[model samples]
Target chain A: MSYVVGVDAGGTSTRALAVAPDGVVLGTGRSGGANPNSNPPEKAAGHVETAIREALGALEPASANACVIGMAGTAKLTDPQVAALFSAVWERLGLTGVRIVTDPEVAFASATPAPDGTVLVAGTGSIAARIRGRRMVSTAGGYGWLLGDEGSAFWLGREAVRRALDELSGTGRLGELTRSVLAAADVDAADRSLAWRRLITVVNGEAPVRLARFAPLVSAAEDAAPILDRAARLLAELAFAARDPGESTPLVLVGSVLAGPVGARVREKLDGLDVRSSTDGVLGAVRLAGIEAFGEDFATVPGDLPRVP
Target chain B: MSYVVGVDAGGTSTRALAVAPDGVVLGTGRSGGANPNSNPPEKAAGHVETAIREALGALEPASANACVIGMAGTAKLTDPQVAALFSAVWERLGLTGVRIVTDPEVAFASATPAPDGTVLVAGTGSIAARIRGRRMVSTAGGYGWLLGDEGSAFWLGREAVRRALDELSGTGRLGELTRSVLAAADVDAADRSLAWRRLITVVNGEAPVRLARFAPLVSAAEDAAPILDRAARLLAELAFAARDPGESTPLVLVGSVLAGPVGARVREKLDGLDVRSSTDGVLGAVRLAGIEAFGEDFATVPGDLPRVP
Candidate 1:
């Protein structure tokens, strides 16, 4: 009855799963966001422990033979104090040696059965990584929303607004994109100049990273085809940048942007690549734990996360 | 004596100058930042009024025949509430009519006394504008720090940090820039991976716009030649984008970036072009006021702004 614990700590939520050595689903749990970059260390760590505790239901704590926690913004934990906070959580869970990694690694594992591959993620932010033996050995672009993330959701959303701004400033022809952008911004203005200025005000009024919200509106606009084209090309370029040309391996697409119309466009651009979509990151965490506990062959455990939401 | 009041309301400080039709300096005053986008609207307007009222010392407020207030982030005032806030300040100053223009317009006029020319500004942010009749007729780029501002201080700084991150991530080589970036971030990790993670944490800790602080360090780096080269090329491209070929208007360079080595490089890139540096934007505002109140002949008012700082 030795069980392995797996956790996915994201910006919005935290989820955990426990699976026996033979892949019997033991338990599951979820809690509020546990990303220390977005949440306080004390609170984030507290939630991680809460989720793990709940997932260890009924079984003796020592029965958890191995554990893995995958978190977005894992770089934030590089600080000694933040690292201490999470390590304390591990001690409380009675786990002696727990593995922690960035969410991209787990996402890559969930999508395909490969020890080495390329992973392209495009959500509120975007990044691409080259995974070797289930670990990210190198990355192409993960400079966050400010420096890079060129083809991420934020880039596409900013492009949509840029096109509208250009049209409003008399550089380009106004069309459905302009209307959709204005409508999305809830700016009612008869004059194009006012609308243009209003859009800037609205966008700047919030956190700059939240610009990703407008990304969906781009898919609804006709002229957004150009943006989609650039996104797919940039995303594919990033994925290609991570892998050696002659080496053929699985290419994993993760997050909402890479799972939607943007993903389809990226798929077309990456025609010959072996591609797959990540179904659930928690499942990936479970599989990773399986590997760490029972070696590579056992890493492909029977589905133990069928009901994980 | 009849006079025109010119105000340069910036993010750090607001300066006001009163110039007589005969081009003699009447009075001058200064106050804190009044950029409504960065400051509270009420406080910004109060600063504007304070700067103007103090500049009107011992002079009849009504004697100001024309008044012009140049401010950055003018797009923020497009909001009715923000506009009304400034209008109240005008009423408090007892000004009959106040012309409000973007900072680039005033910067253009300050440099060469051209009624129509090209203005390039690259300080904390960057933008290129085509000035027509002392007004911004068209702009090539000014999309702010998040979306655009290609060669601004923020862009340069982000490039420096990006270069360091790339080096740490294996795509680039460690050099003077890497050491400078790491030292500036106060990350003392010996291992490259730990240093890379720490650098990302340091950057994501603060407001992204503040990355401009690191821009100056890039200039201090030995291998910043490529960044400088790319900056000059991109800036020239933007200025070129704002106008048609063969039309030789005065190309105005403003802001700290354009006044430094970066500017010298940019000048080298643009051979055979009429170029000038804007000493102070308040001079431009004064010239603009002189043009509005005094017809074209008086618009040639010799030394419209002599002592403006």
Candidate 2:
């Protein structure tokens, strides 16, 4: 059986999976911090290699024909500087061949079995993309915490902190969600200023992923407010913009944040739009690599990638 | 000469200027912090009274005619609770009639001597207003630093801090404005993170005006960048929105930041638009009170308030 590898590289962590021709998981691997934007190109590639090695070690005999890495900075993969670094690493690893794409592209491919559709990804960052008749069109937001990332985890997290500070200072008109989120986060009146300031610093400086991690807490407390309504509207706009108005295609929802209430809110906002939540992107990456490496109908094959033992 | 009192109630301090119908400055007063949103109505009113008393004390004998206070919390001035406190304070100080308007209106009047014109004020906060004939239209912003005050000193200061952080972290590819502003502010590499974070925290929290005071430094360092371009565009949009397109009226620029190079940038962006800058809002407040107290044909009389002694 032919083998393939799929990698999802993130800000603080990277997850890699090895799979067979029949779409069955063969092995898994993990590593720390692989975002190229955050580290040197060599260091980023090293992180990916570490993840691949760990995933391969899990298998008795590594059966990997080709590898596809879905990374955060793959949007710049085609750049001469970035491509040279990645190519050097791939060659050093003695891999047969490797394909690279942005993390969102892989997530979109994995979300739907269909070749042509749309995927709305909302995570530490947000982007919407449509794969229409072999061409991809996309819109990205959450460039960082500073600019406009409207409905992003960082945005919500920062808002929660700001609202808490406002409440403590008596300048804010408290809403139920803001109060509860602050309470659940254990921010009190005395330390509210300090905690809120720290949260803002975290959002502006270090890991914005930490803010996305609080998505559940913030979503659980969200009530019917203009702020939430505006977010919902923005999500719907992203979804609709990624979809073809003239053609009918399945709309898939990917990303962890989109798997829960935020997705539910998005779907509610879409109302009549065709959409579904995707289970896994790595699996989709494997299928995509198989189709590109083999043929278009490869996903139809069964028991392709069995767990190696 | 008919007497009038104009108060500029700021976040950290309050200042009152008593003027005569002839536009002659009579007296001036100063007091401490008094924002109704943060302090009780009684406390805020007491602060206002202290400021007024100081100005009244400068006069040989305080002229009693009419009073107009250009205050920060005039939006809530009409509220019964706040109104009652002001009324009690006015009676206690032997001041009879008083009219309250937002600080924006005062700035607008002060910026433009013409009875009908527009003023864009960008201080710690930002707001734009136009007086066409007898009607006034306005847009208020910069309540909190999180949402932003686009063209204000707060925005410029916070942006400087953000760019400095970006440069320190090696994440910025844009311009040198951030680095220059940081160096100008005397924040070094060792203290960069803390200093940057502190600036953002202070701007967002207790004293937004303090950070706003750094806007000129940012303006001095600003070059051609998308961020600065957007800021200029926002000012143009605000200016145009404040006035009717059919009518031709001078657009006055107020606030410390707007009086600098940033205002020139805004003016360039608004090429062909009638815009100019004014030195201070107190002057406009004096002019507006004169027009309201006397007839529209009142000459260029000196402000009536007793001069500071």
Using DockQ as the measure, the top candidate is 1
Looking at candidate 2 chain B, the ten consecutive residues that score lowest on lDDT are B299-308
Worst 10 residues of 1 chain B by lDDT: B300-309
- lDDT (Cα, tens digit) per residue for candidate 1, span B116-153: 88998899888888888878878877878766788889
lDDT of 1 at B207: 85
The pairs that clash in candidate 1 are none
lDDT of 1 by residue, A1-309 (tens): 787888999888899999887887889999989999899989999989988888988878777778889998787787899999988888877887799888989988887667899889988888899999999988888888877888888998899888887777664557888778888889865787667767887998988778888899888777788998998899988888888977689999998888778899999988887999887888888888888887776666734358676
* True-vs-predicted CA distance for residue B74, candidate 2, Å: 19
Give lDDT: candidate 2, residue B271: 75
Query: Per-residue lDDT for A1-309 in model 2, tens only?
Result: 566777777778777787666666667887777778777767788888887777666453324666777777654565588778777776666676687776656666665556677777776666676676423554433234443455766666655655554454333466676566556555543554454544443443534456555555566665534445555667667667666575567677766667666677788876765677765555556666676666666655422443222
Indicate which candidate wins on TM-score. 1
lDDT of 2 at B145: 55
Q: Candidate 2, residues B1-309: lDDT per residue as tens digits? A: 457666767666777777766666677888876667667777888888998898787453335566666667665665788888888988888876677777666666655556677777776767676666523543433334554466777777666655554454333353567656556555544554455444343434544346665566676664635556666777677667566766577777877767666777898976786677764445555556566677575425533333333
